[model samples]
Target: MSDLATCLNGDLLCTEDATRLEEEEDDDEDDRFVFLMSRSAASDSEEYIRFLFSRERSFGDFGHAGGGDSLMRARSAAVRWILQARIRLRFSLQCAYVSVTYLDRFLLRRTIDSNQPWIMDLLSLACLSLAAKMEEIKVPPLPQFPAKNNYHGKSVLRMELLVLNTLEWRMSQATPFVFLGFFAYKLAGELASKELLRRAVDFIFAAIEGTNLVDFRPSAVAAAAIFAASGSPPTEKSMNQGMPIIESPELDQILSCYEIMIQAGASPGVGVKRKRLHLSNGSDL
Candidate 1:
């Protein structure tokens, strides 16, 4: 099985396991959960972080000479539209994330004429369709996709082929969602209810809408989302309360990324001030 599948199905506790684990002794379960968090944290080394950064860099057109602002606006608009459509269709958050990744990467490499705005919609359709296929178990047929956008099935297919080629068939690129389950588990431990994780995932989706957040690594974003969702102040007591403290290197990295999100005006207001305090103290947590 793919790493994502393994993480989602086994390490992160599928539905059955979650229900079963709830019945286990609290202390024993907390110990086991701590062990899993340690293992996950240990695996996320500097090299691993660099690898994710490099992979993200490989996608998305960060630098385009002239008309860059306009391009970003168009891209942002398309992303918003795609996200709304995904919600309407009841697609998974993963599908929206992957589709945006594909769309940005495609736009980075392939320039679209600003006058031909309809092509952007077509591209969004193609990317979203491909993402749905990748992440959804019961993907709607291409013909059945919403027609309000006026995308023809044949054109979408052609764009999909082009995107597949451009990405070198790498549809399973690492995304923030990939790290969410692990981080959420680390933050809440056995107490990490599905609702908490869902809120964190929701924050992630919200963060993705910010074009300024494009440069941050997915792992960092995942960590920040968890931090924001936990409602735990970044202070020493808050950070260490109810769970194992997030140690240095990792803690610093997540704080830096979270600050960036805050500066971009993208973070939820729940823990923003407390995070600033934690940053000021440089406390280990």
Candidate 2:
């Protein structure tokens, strides 16, 4: 054998040091740290964290890998459903969007059988509570997630702690929907008749609802919402192409969603009857 081999076989080398190094490597491999870790382990964890936050998953695009359907179409349908259903009160669309975002983040770490729909409700409530806490200082202490058979506020309160823990306290406050609402009104313009403006808002709400389906780019949702609310009937050909493209397919889908909103009694109505606020200033009067 070579001279080095001969030295290693003879007791001329530090065998104890080699054995100790091997033992140390094995120990590191076997360690199960909760959070704290050695340098190598910490590096691995940091890589994982980076992966988690890397690409923001959009629910509108979730099912694209599974079929021929475009991501935009599914998202469009979902947005329509949310707006039509009126799932949350006040700016609930904003709540829904934030909740959906949280659900997307959670799903990256945990996979669920897509067949189980109740998980959607759980995630939705978790998002709502998180957003509410962030949005309102005097928010309801706990979420009021509705029960299957009862509307007891107590039942929703009981589940609050569990939901909070599951979310790990990451609740986003801003949503594209809220911003889109203002944009839609502005685009309809002061010159537009009241009926025209109201119709535009109705369509915009439908587009906002569309965001719920497939993973859609928020910008595209904004465009689709605007297109739908523009007081123009969307053609079926446009809807097929889907939002951001503004083709026939997309227009069709928007129109269909609008029809669904109307059938579901979600069409925007005349502003709530309100006594006109009388300012002390007599400039207008």
Candidate 3:
């Protein structure tokens, strides 16, 4: 309770708060310099990175936390809806990420999901179309999704305007991939162990798969998952082992819930097969 109270009181700074303000300023300078250098390089890769970083900075300026985990919240269902729709429709991962951003931004303005799974595909395509217009030099034609579903072109165009109006014409977008990568790197510093870093990466990716699950809180789930996988304890660490060991039952519960949510959000299209080549093999189904 003391730790929680301290965290609530703002006296307990997360890793970032402990850093000197000067150092934080230096880091910002470094990010700016990197963007500038990349722009001078003038390659497609640089352009894409520039676009992402621009969007990230805009999110930060607008009080949106700039982390992949921030994009995931226990109370928010829209991100998961977009994610699930992308999976079901077999949309590219990059496109899915773009759609998730679009969906999140839209939710900032309007109520979303309302526990309805059926309308998700419609919302997902609309979000992706909006993202395509913003991110693509030439927007890709909306592909005919499936035999059973034919989204009206007029409907899509209408929804695009609705989304734009909902977002108040603020079109900057940021995906979680960059922030996730940075968070992993920072955790490596905190743990100072290669094995811990590997485990953290594994945990982040696993929790990311659960972005579709409503109960999964991105930042808390991410921190807890990484803490569990790294065998690290908060506010304490073994001198023998570099990484902190979070060996608490409460932490266990959080990690278990994360896994449960991921399983629940599992797409029906993919199945884990348990088959054996020999006669002694287990049931395939």
Best by TM-score: 1
Q: State TM-scores per candidate.
A: 0.62, 0.42, 0.43
Ten-residue segment with the worst summed lDDT in candidate 2? 19-28
Worst 10 residues of 1 by lDDT: 17-26
Runs of candidate 3 with Cα error greater than 4 angstroms are 1-94, 112-120, 133-140, 146-148, 189-285
Q: Among all windows of ten consecutive residues in candidate 3, which has the lowest summed lDDT?
A: 17-26
Winner by lDDT between candidate 3 and candidate 1: 1
Which regions of candidate 1 fall more than 4 Å away from where they truly are? 1-67, 212-214, 232-257, 260-285
RMSD of each: 14.3, 22.5, 18.1
lDDT for each residue of candidate 3 in 41-137, tens digit (9 for 90 to 100): 2232434544554554455323233223433342244454444444344344445455655665554444433343324445556777676566545
Model 2 scores a TM of: 0.42
Candidate 2: list runs displaced more than 4 Å: 1-93, 104-110, 114-118, 149-174, 178-201, 204-214, 233-266, 269-285
lDDT of each: 0.57, 0.36, 0.41
Indicate whether candidate 1 or candidate 3 has the larger TM-score. 1
Candidates 1 and 2 compared by lDDT, better number: 1
